[model samples]
Target: MSSFAALRRAHADARFKCIFLRPTLASQRLGCPVSPFSCRLNSSTSESHVSDAPTEETPIVASEKTVPSGDDTLFHKALTPSGRRDLADRIIQDGKELHKLNVELKNLQRFARSTELLVKGSPWKVAKHWFATPFKEDVTLDNGVIRVGSQTVPNIWLRDNCQCNSCMHQETRQRLLDTFSIPEDISIKTAAEFRTAIEVTWSDGHQSTYDKDLLREAGANSEKKAVIRQGQVDIHLWNASIAESKPQLNWEPESRPHEKRVDKFIQGVLQRIRRFGFCYVNRMKATPEATEKLLRRIAFIRETHYGGFYDFTADLASKDTAYTNIALGAHTDNTYFSDPAGLQAFHLLSHTDGKGGASLLVDGFKAAEELLHSDKEAYHILATVHVHGHASGNDGISIQPYKGFPVLEHDAETGALLRVRWNPSDRAAVELPLEEVGKWYAAARKFDAILKRKENEYWEQLQPGTLLIFDNWRVLHGRSAFTGKRRICGGYINRDDWISKYKMLHFGKEDVLKNLAAG
Candidate 1:
């Protein structure tokens, strides 16, 4: 009973003001006196109705037609309990609806200056003064969503990101609330704009005041997140022009350039690979472990059936073509993988013994771009047609058919080349419609011709004490048949792992990685 009396007083105080001060009356608009039980009298000498309420006072029983308020529902035994909830629920359902009744009451509107305008049900100073700049359209809210403009932000998302004292630690800027505690279908009770922020009182009575700048940034971040989920790779398109000024980073690994300077140099190399898809490291460590150590600088060596790392020599009778004394054609490795290795590093341990092992570099992305501009039909056909592959002499005992991909992979929405898979040696069988298979072969031929163009091919005689690393997704690698014993050591790195290392190296954090994915 005492609690109920206290709540009534709080509610009354919230809706009314002291008339002794000559303050405006909200009931004036209704042309009636405000219920003394619901409104506070304005006077320091006047006693409040709540303090006067006694436990022995006769209970004012409500009629069936009378709706129960938040405080009204609390006097169960005294006034006959009814089906109702607390104040929080009432505010969400019908209290001061912005679209109905007085828009001022619904929104955080300007205070009334004229006393004549003050009336019952008028948007008087409810609790505190609020300066709000509202949106144009009527706000729409749902479970985990608040549609503001073109974007719909998740309620749970917004609540979790609340920068309030209860939600986050001020000094650390670390979240304090448990994300899982938020209901999956949580809804917004009321939404209004402030001069610099938007105030949202949730159905659960949790209030979130987000800055306007924060909401705008959130909308942008939401769109960027969606884009990242679709395609996490960025690329640079080029042709023979890539050959004119190769994206080269000539740094000696053994020299151990000053730490800060070396870090910048490493970052530059990574940037080159990110932009041009390949980079050359001149005067690098010349050893069997050179390529392996270099991979650690970026990420762990991608361990496939090839074990960890390898030394390519003129082992004539070896099962793998790379090991034999044969000319390898222009191709990206790991066509057999669904997500192939992204970075490939080659260190010339001993190239003097070799005769014609000059590395042939061709940009598959460059070829695809050319084909796309000159022949859109060919590009589309190649991009759509899927080709199967198999790793014949892999270390794995069980021979499982590797997942396949089209010769050219493009984003359906942006028509951007996402990945390229071309390996004649690893090609398995063509499993496609008869009509489509012929078209695929023709498209592949045209793309291959572009790759084979002399202007597009950048031949570099990889010398000892030099390390060459290229993007397996963009630049195709090949080697001319060699005579003498050539010893080349290299390794493959997972695409995602390399990207992760690159992002961390350049940005020193993961938050900015999404921006790098865009062209």
Candidate 2:
């Protein structure tokens, strides 16, 4: 019989005696005269008959019962036919599960036994048993780490990261091997370490290598880089002083300069936007199409009811206050947009015979940060409250804005300021509770005061051929009322595209890992 079968038989016999057998001395002490009913002490299961006889119509029924222990089970004897079947099935199932578990345990032991897992000069195994696997691959020791491939990785990690045709999907580039699929006995076939990296041929005959520096950058020390993302604005709060040397970048020459010069100009403009969240471009043709071309160089134009770009000339039909020369408040262009435009660009095509049309800018993030510090409760209220914004009119075009967002968007984990959206004109009527109404108004008023403060305002009388772009989510823009003709044209770019472009320009290690996982 198999070892498991013998073990199962012994277990059953032991349990049978425990339930059905009793000592002769014990029966005698109970005053039940020991006749043929006495049990043998030496045998495991000494069968006996009860003194009380059964009638002809009745027969003793056998039964087996089970009890559970913390991690194992036990069976009691006198098993019925059905009980014997259950016991057999349970024993088989338990044996199978136990065998699987033991295999995993043995795998771990074998892994630890391999010299590939041992540190240099390991004394656990004699030199003879250490070189069981040979490899044509190279290995390396780098900066206090034993590198496998270019990374200081464990043997299991190396085994898991195998990227041969069988291990990884060709089309998706994702690994196919799972923990269970990688057997416990998996090991390094051959390995070596070098100055810069490590290489190993796995027991499966697949070779892999890793660099030392890349692995460290990929894990453990990545917390800081994980929090901040590329293309996310690093807002620099500024006041009126920003206008003196404001974020300014000149446009490419009308004659079209050399490619290098054009590249430099475009790079400078993008970098300026990264730093100041806004920039003023110079020397562009005063036409709608030309303005679009300039904006497209940065990103695609975001379209809306206002069309591909807005011409701020005196117009009739649109419900927007922007079409009129009325003084405008500092606010994001699309407060009613669910995913509001990330950036807004404006090109001053012509400003012929106009007065009091100065553009004003307020760093909403800066203002929100101040509110967060001065009245943390109020800040919390704003961040938590869902303020709705909407815009509608009887202008035959069936468009009505209905969007909601907190005035101050913050990182949930770190409480860091992220995006700021504050637009009073487009703010839908609030229906807060009587008590909460007053507090909300107070918070709103305080935030407004900070935005209008002279220290937070940057006004400029934009001249012709000047293109202004700003992060609409971070910086709020407005205009003073104008008297005469003032024409302008510009477009919007989706935030994701700009971020993608920025990431390409400034790709980081985290991005690499994210892409790999996505695949």
Candidate 3:
């Protein structure tokens, strides 16, 4: 017989003995006792007594019986006395406990699964991973999808893709491409897809893959569209022509010949002014005569400082002069004037006497552009808010006016930016409702902080005879205080005169004269 079968037979024998064997000392100790009638087993041998006694017709009674056990009985023996009555009760309780534990375990597992799914499904998690990855190397593009870093973007922008040479290289002179009608059957295959890498498939059966870093460097989203026009004069030639025609001032000897050299130099300076909003004329000796001549040659000059022709002058030797102060913060000149100066000319007549007097120029336009791109809502708030500038010092000149000019304005025709107005302390209370005041303050503060950064500052020392002219409306000028003596001559040319001069030199003599008459 098999081992399992032999073990089963032994257990059965033990159960039979416990149920029907004679009452022994060991059986009583185990809490099990043999029945009295069961122990009398010689029925056939004692048949005569049984028949005579049975003939008496003794009545058989069926009554529930209990077996008694002492307090010292073992747990197993007490549980299974003779019949399976108490053992069945213990089994039912154990089965109920096991079922309750199984249910609890299932509930815990379900909760864990839900939590895992929630974290995996969050968009914030996806974005965080995308930004943290190194994105400057290569961009991955396959078929129609573009992958920037870890982000997989859809191909819906295919129609907007600009690959023409005119759009790609702005400085190049190329024929503009003719516009074509889009095909009606064009359809995108997928909205977005992400894998170990991106795959893009075009409808024309063309496929492409690009490294994610390279795609980012290509500036896919930041690329701008510009219209290319033919028959336009080259910028260099145009500048040269303007310089050749420019008038020369008499204060300083022509460092170059009046006809050939001065015209070329002036043209170069004007080009720089137009392109950068400011430019420097160097090599002229620093003197009051030279500064005055330079200012007059440009156009009529504005006298600042309460009807004073030399409204602003830097005299380092004279402590009484306003120009000797070293700690001048960034500000636009003539805040008190009814019409603020449009252009400012500063001629450093002498710099050898000063130690720390360095000129600092900031491109307010660039700062404003950064603000617009990073926080558009803030840019809008600052742009729409009205600010009042009042200057009340020395001779008591106070002028209040309202202007809707933005801190940053774009040229309507060329789309070039024109930066204007950056004076935080002079900013008047905004006309916005009380509810929006907090938001306005926050935005203005952010803009000012960006402008104050050193990265935005262009530092230079004004050498003697160096005349620096800048668009006063768009450029903010400041200086660092020095201990030594320094002298400078400052003045302004009205916006009308400057524009008239530009048009006269570029557009035509008639247009220039008409604009001058209109002004």
Instruction: Estimate the overall C-alpha local distance difference test score of candidate 3.
Output: 0.49
**Candidate 2 residue lDDT tens string, 162-212:** 555667775666777775666666677766665655676777677776553
Order of models, best TM-score first:
1, 2, 3
Better of 2 and 3 by lDDT: 2
Local accuracy of candidate 3 as per-residue lDDT tens digits, 225-291: 1111100111211111222333222333655547445444555555456545677776676666666
| Cα TM-score per model | 0.62, 0.61, 0.47
lDDT of 1 by residue, 376-462 (tens): 667666766678887767444423345557887754433345688888878887766575478678877889899999888878888
Prediction 2 global C-alpha lDDT: 0.60
Error of 1 at 462 (Å): 0.7
Q: Which 10 consecutive residues of model 2 have the lowest summed lDDT?
A: 30-39
Which pairs clash inside model 1?
18-42, 19-42, 26-119, 26-120, 27-119, 27-120, 28-119, 29-119, 144-155
In angstroms, the error of model 2 at 234 is: 5.7
How far does residue 223 in candidate 2 sit from its true spot (Å)?
6.1
For candidate 3, give the lDDT of residue 61.
30
Candidate number achieving the greatest TM-score relative to the actual structure: 1
